[model samples]
Target: MLRLLALRVLVATGFAVAPAIAADFPPRPVGQNQAGIGQDVNYRIEIAAGPSSLPTVVGPVSRIKDIATIQTARDNQLIGYGLVIGLQGSGDGLRNSPFTEQSIRAMLQNLGIAMEGGQARARNVAAVIVTATLPAFVQSGARIDVSVSSLGDATSLQGGTLVMTPLRAPDGDIYAVAQGPVFISGFSAQGQAETLTKGVPTAGRIPNGAIVERQIEARFNDDEVLTLQLRNPDFSTAIRVTDIINDYTASRFGNRTASEQDSRTILVKRPASVSAARFVAEIENLLVATDTPARVVVDERTGTIVIGQDVKIAQVAVSYGQLTVRITEQPQVVQPAPFSRGETATEPSTVIEADQSGGQVAMLDGPDLQTLVAGLNRIGVKPDGIIAILQGIKSAGALQAELVFQ
Candidate 1:
């Protein structure tokens, strides 16, 4: 009896300490991932800095919109299985794709109709998968675009309407409903002689197609600080963004509120009595002077070469020459000259010419794109030859730029 009383006293002591311990730690507020409405005007930085000696050009200042966005306010993809109807006898064969027939039969049964067919053999029906992105902060009843692709052997989805399909997220919950007429980007027509096709006739898009039915709550407003994530990560660009925000915010608030987190993120502390949304808008509107790295991108398949303005080449020499070969069918028939018992014989001639210009050591000082082109033109070569020369320059450690081959 004494031991039991001791155990009961210990249990009572544990219960008494639980409330005190719980008071020390508070519950954390759950943050939702939601997108907010931004200005419709685009604030894009059309950077053509490295292409030439021209300074980095920033696009026109857009009104009421910021280029940078807060972290975690991203898009969510919702996908569904649906059926596209009204094809021109170019759909999945029931014998081949049993799933297509099964879908159609199930759809028909849902509409209070019963078909006693083993499998659907309709030539106008097709099985398709519908996909749409749910932007953060989108509420229910808002329309978004959807992309549909043929999941069966359907030739074209033109002039077809997608059946009511429920788009579900990764959590297996229905988020939005997508049902609209399919608009194919390309068309395909076939006859006995030949077939003509442009773009993808089986794939199509519907503008403002899927309706938003769920909300993604974000927690940017709850936190005392907000971070701006750059679309492209660069140390110089990140520093510039931070300085611009600090300069502007300090002028208004008399204190710097922004700090560079890393090469891609800028952390800004919300000021007293100012809303998080207002602070984010002010930071995004501030123009940043960005820098570019020297890079040379080339598409050999298209014979297109893009050289950066910062590209410099050490003193190098380039020499190019063309070689031509010719074969002439000049046959000479010599009759028995003066009938001296000589048989007629034919002689053939061949000619070859090699034109090699003397090599010259030309200095290449790439101060501007025009000067660079002029220096290369002095060698008088085609684009292919220019590519070879540039490759050689890079190999020789003369070209100071990152060469990217695409």
Candidate 2:
């Protein structure tokens, strides 16, 4: 009995000692696991510094519209066909790229040469399409950048020269001519049996390659009324814009209708008997505040979320869990007995594994935005994890603001 009692005491001591040893383990460092919280702030505001009001004499207050005219807010697109030459054997093969051969042949024929076989074998020339945008109010002889893309099977356009190409606008009128050396920031190299490449090889750009040949005629001062178009139309924003304009104009000229109608448009009455240019110059200097909606935008691909300041959420409980399923296939071969008239066979052995995380439901009675953010942070979840939680909450009709996912 004495021996038995001693044995029992030793067993109990061993059990307790094992747990005590484990309990004395060191704590993990805080830096071992940490995550950045919240979204980045990317908002900008611009304010004009000038007189806010001006007198109008040409039209009634109701006839005056916004100061920003449509002519100043438009751009023109130009396109042209060109040739890129002087490639290091990277130019399109004439036999494979018929268009390259045809283009070269046509160009040579125009220069008083003809090919009997209807094809030209050239290793230094490539057909390309050039494009550029002529900004509003561009003047003749101004230089503009242009993009050149090979229309053939050329491997690279590096160190190439672009022939003079006439760029045409949508109106089918030649407005610019592009001609310069192509600048390609990409390259390719060939090996005995393999090739390596970086960036785009067939596309390139020419800085200041296009010279404006014609100017688009736009007159902002000739109109008696000018229209101000809103980038984003909102009723409340429109009202605020109107009020700001009216206040500024009223101070200078009593009860001017420079701000009228919904915010979508504002009217500015040009000062009668004055040069249209001077009248336009006065109103363009006016300043107005703008507002945006309270919303949240999410890009799932990049795990990015942008939330406006006015976004809010209601009380809710959230639980996050992860499930993993793994499948492995092992192939096996079965050989028929030697001398037997049976063929060998193959089979696949499949193994499946499933794991479920130990998750706990968290109760959140968030009364404000700070509380909501804190509650979410306590779960130690990632952006993707939070996305699912937010989606669930929205489906349950708990989230207050709009949830837009892209």
**Model 2, span 1-406: residue lDDT tens:** 0000001111342321111101111222223211123553221122223333433222212212342343332466777877898988889888887777777777778889877864456788888989898887678999999999998888999889998799976545688999999998889999899999999989988999999998776554445555566666655555555566566656655655454445465555555656657655655565544455656678899998776555567666677778899999998999999999989899889999999883768876555556777787888788888888878877887777788988
For residues 141-203, what per-residue lDDT tens digits would candidate 1 score against the true structure? 899999999988888999998989998765556778999899998999999999999999999
TM-score per candidate, chains pooled:
0.74, 0.69
lDDT scores in order: 0.70, 0.67
Residue 127 C-alpha lDDT in model 1: 92
Quote the lDDT for 352 in model 2.
Answer: 96
The candidate scoring highest on lDDT is: 1
Q: Where does model 1 exceed 4 Å of error?
A: 1-67, 321-363, 377-382
- Each prediction's total of clashing residue pairs, residues at least 3 apart in sequence or on different chains, is 5, 11
True-structure Cα RMSD, model 2? 26.9
